[model samples]
Target: MGKQMFSKPPIQKSHELLLPTTKESCWILVFLLAFGVSSIHGDDGKIDFRYHHYLDLSRVLNDTAASCHEISRVYSVGKSVEGRDLWVIEFSDNPGVHEPGEPEFRYVGNMHGNEAVGREILVYLVQYLCSGYQAGDARIRRLIDQTRIHIMPSMNPDGFERAATLGPDSPRTSTSWGSYGRLNSERIDLNRNFPDMLPVWLLQEESQRRNHHVEIPEWYWDTLVAPETLSVILWSLSQPFVLAGSLHGGSVVVSYPFDSCGLRKVMRSYSEAPDDALFRKLAKVYVDGHRKMGKCGQVEPCNARNFTCKGGMTNGAEWYCVPGGMQDFSYLVTNCLEMTFELSCDKYPGEDELQTYWEDNKEALLSYMEAVHTGIKGFVRDGSGKGVANATISVEGVDHDVTTGELNIFDIKTYFLIPQRLTETTGDCSFRGLTG
Candidate 1:
């Protein structure tokens, strides 16, 4: 029993203190307490925490699948200028929705890079749905069961990386105009660069003519090719029964069709026909959702019953005639119902206030989701059989509305469509829905 090293504490010290007299003695007490707690608590594991960021988000998505074994897939639509993969994570009980002929509900975020909360919200939404489903939450389960959600967390990864690396304090007035951190190398506003080019240009030119000045940035004319912008347009065009929205930041608002020149006459001039009932319904959905968010001040009445038209830049199917853009292209080529959602107030709200924004907008966001679930859409055509230009279209059930532009149509329901213009090339058009 050589030295019986460390076999016991000093007898004299133990007697003096009436307690553990050595470091080894203290270890035993700590271990015992830990074991006792474990025994009592049965070792509940750590709670998973989620945050915004592509890699971290992907890991969370992977962890979620491993933990719950739910149905989900991370698919790439195209490559960014930096060669980063632009991903769309699909979540649904039925992954089969990706199969040919199935409908899709698209929710995209971070198109401008500076507005990153949508990425987090989208990721959180997935986690919420999956966790809720596992926990037997009926509403969550039903939504997943009925709808296929396609979430593109960061549409402009190149720009997003630039923004993240430069930090938040970087001046917005920096001379570097075409960096991936701000806009594409071409410097075109991705939000304004959809395929509906003609209507957009017309509106832009009209605005300049009215003001008797040219304020359009030089960069707008410099970059003609937008890969990131093109990919989203192409992806939307490929989908069926698609009700899609592009999420942006700055003034909190929900804007629908006729984004191009925002005049009633401009809209009417472009749309071969008019569809008042449909326009009113779609506007109502947006109006109702905005009211719930405490954003009553920003919700403007659209060009429908008791609604008034407010002029703004034309984008989407209602304003432009183009070959690209998520909404315009989707409406022109795929016949999907699409809209753009501006989330959060200007200057990007602080992280602490993000929850409030979410709470206010969640119902409105879900209304869009609900619209997709119900498969509600409408179409407008001109007299010439070519899809009409600047026509107002709406969905009766959800109160969603959009104006259609040259060679484009509007989808009220899932935002999917067949290519057909109004029979009249230059005059008013007619539209009908399930109601009215």
Candidate 2:
């Protein structure tokens, strides 16, 4: 006999307590139950899960790691102001500490509290890669062997918890600092708090009353001097790995280079310094990938004519003219290639679409990752076989990776452009480029 499909509910009407079973009926019930539970868990009228529910995610990651010991490990990068551990899960096939010379990659999610899906995507990717790789999945194994993936699931744990605990339908008008969800308890926009690349002076009585000692908001002052941003800066500066992508949401877009205003000025001139072609190439890859995913948005250059620069605050690294943005900073300061990937649409899509987004982005992300592993090395040469001077080269694409162990921010490589000057000659000038 085939398996029975329907079991009577505990409470039934007197008229009909018994019913015939059917396989289709059983399948329907199972589907409904699964869908209902997922919807409930992903409730609050948004596809994103509540931030405090990260504990459940942690458990899921732990279970997957235990089952597939070689491909994944859960670790902490730091602690939030609220003292919650900033969890980072490393996914790679290489089971030991990466040798000094090995390539690495970093993928960070949830830098902002409201953009929570990245954490889910990171977790899902880890599980998928581990399971897929163990099954002799060619693509998975290749990615694992070639690159190391360092994923920070939640950069702003405090903000995430606050947003989630507040519920999705909560009033947008809430005035609490946490309700705004951009800053910590101290109300500093981490993105804006970086050292200002171009500082504007505000002349006030305090400005005229300079003193050796002054009382100020300690948290504000301390954050202005915080070592956290500096630590990430130092870490990325010390590595030679390929690409890094800082993931965000609210719009499906991939942004590249010179996020701060001064850098834009430097890049505007044809002779002084031009835009990097490598960045353009990567942007193309991202745009193509998104288009393939049915998301038809162009990859916008960071320094486009219409790009916004005014009112932009620089981080510490940016202020010292350090190009200290996570992506631009990695590229300009360290010469490591990086891009800011804004994942998903402006209004949050439903949870049902999450898997689809991942699938669509897989190839583009993988291609970019591969580009980083094999450094995109090239030389611009003139017609006379001599190197071209002041010629800019940019390469852009989806960035992905696998890591050996403890994927440190410092370990990821930056995309670099080595400009060499060619002596002036009489022959008609032409240029050439190459990548490994």
lDDT of 1 by residue, 5-96 (tens): 22222222312211111111000000000000000111112223233555776676667656555666677888776676777777677663
lDDT for position 332 in model 1: 35
**Highest-scoring model, lDDT:** 1
TM-score of 1: 0.59
User: In candidate 2, which residue ranges exceed 4 Å CA deviation?
Assistant: 1-52, 169-178, 196-231, 234-239, 263-275, 291-324, 347-350, 374-435
Error of 1 at 3 (Å): 78
How do all models score by TM-score?
Answer: 0.59, 0.59
How high is the CA lDDT of each candidate model?
0.47, 0.45
Cα lDDT of candidate 1 equals: 0.47
lDDT for each residue of candidate 2 in 226-293, tens digit (9 for 90 to 100): 23343354345334445777776654555665454542434322211123444555555554544342
Error of 1 at 194 (Å): 2.7
